[model samples]
Target: MTVLDALPSVEHAAVLDESSKREIRRAILTAIAVPGYQVPFGSREMPVARGWGSGGLQLTLAIVGPDDVVKVYDQGEDGGVNAANLRRLIRRSEGVETTTDPRQATVIQTRHRVPEDELRADQTLVLQVPVPEPLRGVERDMNELRRMHAEGDYSKMWVSLYEDLVRNGVITETTGYPCLVGGRYVIATTPIPRWDVPPLHQAAFLSLFSAGREKRIYAIPPYTDVEPLTFEDVPFEVEKVSARCRCGLVVPDGDLQSYQVEIPQQDGSSVWACSDTDWCTRQRVEAGLLDPSAITETEVDL
Candidate 1:
């Protein structure tokens, strides 16, 4: 059956709160006008905790409609505890349809990892960024940081990287790679894997980033320039897994495959997939893609 057919009916009174919608609409409009600029907004308290995917949840509530199909992922896979919690929150609040198929989704909210495939121009990818500043660590004072960004001063960042090279031989930074957007604005590309970074540069889709605790919103419109910060000798590199997904599945254009693994403990093991739980469950039920019950607590190692 189609995604819409699988979803439950929406209750107009319960779907949206007036204040939240207004705030999001304003933020989105400001994002469109400012392009690479990061705009601050009044983020609301979500049922989910602050560090979780609350930012994405707020955006989903703001943009999702009765007809839109929503898909959420964390760390490339589906059906994890956190992903499932976020899905339950959205489903309870809005009663909208959810899926794992990137091509089938009108909106996608992700954390830490982007899908293994490429997204289209029409779809919107909302990223949950823990930090939004590329120069935050370099300049602790917000006032000074703002001035540096305003004046396009990034010498300190270069100096810092040089220091890292001298001390550690390599940058040593693993997550939250920073990038220069539109050639003028420096922004954090979030904590997504480095493999997902290049696909974001000059992509067809509009990429929106929101940090709830930070109360910041930023965007990279379709075809906008996004370049990673790097020296001429040291080029930017994406992180790659030495092994392919053990599932032996190839992701389609704008889609990804799910894998089940067991995390070992002192006594027993916990078997679960990396994809969002809601996505995996739906896929299993609808397409016979994965068997949830087959995942035992003694077979996988994280």
Candidate 2:
């Protein structure tokens, strides 16, 4: 049987323990009532490294059921070492099916990039955040940062960015962009590509950001305000690609290119694919955009 066909059918009760479901339900309710507050829970130790997607796994285990389809991606690709590692853990621990199709997934755990397509309201996107503090650079003490946030003191962050612009012609930030949620809470939206930032603004889905090592959890519920930290004159800008994919279709507006060596048996030919492997596979299937070395003609013309 094909890999897809060989997969076992989901059985809800078999997937989630009663205790896990109760814990997650409580956390979700607490998150909603407190708004921007961080809710600490008994985070379990995973077989993977602590800094990896442990935070995502914790949240997933809490909410995932036997019947739910899970999708995990790192830098947009399912084949990335980190994504593959997490997928194995989930399958072994929970026995839920995994997929590359965004439409089929009920839960998606991602690092550094968000899917190019708009997420549905029913979907839950969990981000693996390395750091989740907007005031972390200035105040090393969590207590001090909390006070700064309480007083709405963000002038230091603005000044730092201004100085960065003076030194380098543009804002030198490449990841871990800070944003304001509900116009009150200054939250770090994690390292998602700037291209995906706009989608988080009043998005339809629930966006959860967690830093396991740092011991923090934050949320941006549907229809909430989320704006990138920017000055009035210097508006926030998403990344741009100068060239389209050689496959003839325009790369998803914010998709980034990644390189890998492929040795073809014929003459040791090499080629590259989307860095976000899961994203690329979905695009390939849905849009019929084939890699130059894989096929002769465009499989499906966009």
Candidate 3:
């Protein structure tokens, strides 16, 4: 039996036909050519349901090859149900190798988080987006939304944000914050936390966003400007993790703060742990701080 026939139904669905790959590639090229612009395309069949990262899977399948190393993560976890299943599908369907390490992956498909590591120039980060429209909150009418986007009229969005600031004392949005890419086109930053948002601004790797249900694809090319929509007085800030990690590491500024997760303790209180388990283990290994298993004689440089 062939690889396609041997696998289960879900994996079988992801093994896209050649025509679908070509159409996805065409959409990708168009998206890259016009940064932050949501280019519409025909959403093809994939294993996952509409809102469950089918778009990202399709994009990865179109470009990933046998030699490529793929990684899929859901909220920074490599072993989560979603991540594990998707990674298995990609590997089994295409015969491409898979890795949990961000450093080793050529294309990293993510559900709602970006890797904490500084992505290399050669890598491509594909973010799965449930909602691709940044202005949807401000404008409900599709025709009017298109017209506003075409005319670059974001006055209502600015007003809405101002109202949010007035009522909440801060921009209350925790994820899917809107951002201006390439100094034009205010695009939704795909449910990534405020912490993950900064790396996308002037980063080394290219970022692709796909919405399977929405049938749209968009991109932020390498080294492009990505500015969060905020007031001059109210500068954008990431959520802070104040507690020390059980790994004997203190919360370091300017690096992967969003990767921190709160762990409940024996008491009613809780502590913080780095959600990027690989990075945390590496830190422990390198420092010789606590865990010996995570520590090896030689370490791989991130």
Q: Whole-model Cα lDDT per candidate?
A: 0.72, 0.71, 0.85
Please identify which of the two predictions, 1 or 2, would achieve the higher TM-score against the true structure.
2
2 or 3: which has the higher lDDT? 3
Candidate number achieving the greatest TM-score relative to the actual structure: 3
Give the alpha carbon lDDT tens digit for every residue of 5-99 in model 1: 33444565443486777788789778867676788888888766787977777877898878888878787655667776666556656767777
Ranking by lDDT: 3, 1, 2
Q: Which runs in model 1 stand beyond 4 Å of their true positions?
A: 1-10, 13-16, 248-302
TM-score of each: 0.79, 0.80, 0.89
Lowest summed lDDT window (length 10), candidate 3? 293-302
How far does residue 72 in candidate 1 sit from its true spot (Å)?
A: 1.1
| Model 3, position 239: C-alpha lDDT score | 78
lDDT tens readout by residue for model 2, 166-208: 9997886767777888887777777786767788888999888
Which ten contiguous residues of candidate 1 have the minimum total lDDT? 245-254
Report RMSD (Å) for each prediction in the order shown: 7.2, 6.8, 4.5
- List residue ranges in candidate 2 displaced over 4 A: 1-21, 251-273, 285-302
